[model samples]
Target: MAHTIREKNKLLARVKRIKGQLDAVERALEAEAECEKVMHLLVSARAAMTGLTAEVVEDHVRTHLVDTELFPDALREDGVEELLAVIRTYMK
Candidate 1:
């Protein structure tokens, strides 16, 4: 799916921050930080990645599957089906 420059930038920023958090996790491991602290960081990083993935998937569905301007149009059914299939596969 194509993204406008602003949206792309926002996603990139989110990914970059996640990357930084990952790096911090590595550092924490190397420094032998408390296990709970490292685990918490790891969980937060995973949540960030999940959020990013959801955002991208939603954008893709919006652009390639659903036509936002033509909601209620007959052709929209096919798009909905396609998007649902993709999402089901993704869940697996």
Candidate 2:
């Protein structure tokens, strides 16, 4: 997907923050922190990962799922089917 420089920077920043969170989770594991603390960190990390995945999926859909212009009405059904197929695969 084509992203403005600003958008790219924002995504990069998010990825970096997720990386840091992952590192913290690792440290918590190594330090034998409380089980609840480690579990909380893991849950947060998973949430971040899910958000990142969603962002990428949205970008992909915007870029490739449906044409905004010159989209043939006759092909709309096919387009919807293709989009649903992709979304199903991605969700899996």
Candidate 3:
């Protein structure tokens, strides 16, 4: 999306950080770290992914559904509802 392109550097930085988190998890596993330590690493990586997902979703809603004039009011509303449904399911 254009919005993504506009925020490309920021998004890439987040992705890089997330990759580092995943790498840490992998290293912990390879080292046979304690279960709790490994679990914490996994949770950290998951939270990073979730944060990235939320940022992108919020951008999509603002750039494509809320700010754009391309879509009709009804269509925008529908799109927002769809996004909300997906977010609710994801959060669960």
Candidate 4:
């Protein structure tokens, strides 16, 4: 939630691009464009959505679950960084 405010514009821009893709898909259907073209639009929109999902999840992890100032070696040296790395790999 905290990161959302700081990254609001970037997130909104992504949403706008996604809206544009949806509009394109609707128009393509209305015009009865080739299936290939419509499918491309759908694919693009899906990929954009996936990227947005990953980014928000990453921000949530960093904002809510991570503590920057301390890492107990018993917990794993640099545990926060290690957790973040695992999250990044898993999200992808």
Candidate 5:
């Protein structure tokens, strides 16, 4: 979707951050860090991943579903363009 094209850079940045976090976790394990320190790193990485997942899921819902109450003109009038704009942004 055009949304991906527009957000590719932003998405890639998130991925990169996740990768960095994973790498940190790996190094901590390899260095035999304390259990508490390693757990903290793991938890941080998990939280980042969860945040990314939530963003994508919310975007998907917004892309495929619309609330008429929120956009009465869109549902009752010539508002396909408005919906299409949202899809284009969320499809990415």
Candidate 6:
């Protein structure tokens, strides 16, 4: 989205870090690492992904659904509800 252009670098950096975390998990698996260590890596990677999802969702809400100047009140409400429904499904 055009709104994301301003935050592209920041988003890419987060993605890169998440990639590294996943790589670490993969390496740990290949090395037959301890269960506890592997679990920690997996958890870290999952948290990073969750954080990235939250950032993108928040940006979308602010840029698209929350701007009264660009979107009417009823449309914004519907858009927000739809987004919330998606987030609920995602969190599950």
Specify the highest-TM-score model's number.
4
Cα lDDT of candidate 1 equals: 0.76
Global lDDT of each candidate: 0.76, 0.74, 0.78, 0.80, 0.71, 0.79
The sequence of per-residue lDDT tens digits that candidate 3 reaches over residues 1-92 is 45689989998999999889889988988999998998998888888888788777866766665435565453566667787778857753
Error of 6 at 25 (Å): 0.5
Q: Which tens-of-lDDT digit does each residue in 1-92 have in candidate 1?
A: 36634488888889899999999999999999999989999999998887777667766665656555675453465766787677756643
Model 6 segments beyond 4 Å from truth? 1-3, 66-92
Q: What lDDT does model 4 reach?
A: 0.80
TM-score of 3: 0.70
Residues 1-92 of candidate 2 have per-residue lDDT tens digits of: 35434389888998899999999999999999999999999899888887777667656655555554656343465665687567757654
Give the alpha carbon lDDT tens digit for every residue of 65-85 in model 4: 545446422333477578767
> How displaced is residue 20 in candidate 1, in Å?
0.7
Error of 6 at 50 (Å): 0.8
Estimated TM-score per prediction?
0.67, 0.66, 0.70, 0.73, 0.66, 0.69
Pairs clashing within candidate 3:
none
Global Cα lDDT for candidate 6: 0.79
The predictions' CA RMSDs to the true structure, in order, are 4.9, 4.8, 3.8, 3.8, 8.5, 4.1
- Superposing every Cα of model 3 onto the true structure, what RMSD results? 3.8
lDDT of 5 by residue, 1-92 (tens): 43445688998899899999999999999999998998999888888887776566655554445564576445423365565456557544
Ranking by lDDT: 4, 6, 3, 1, 2, 5
What's the residue-level lDDT of 67 in candidate 2?
59
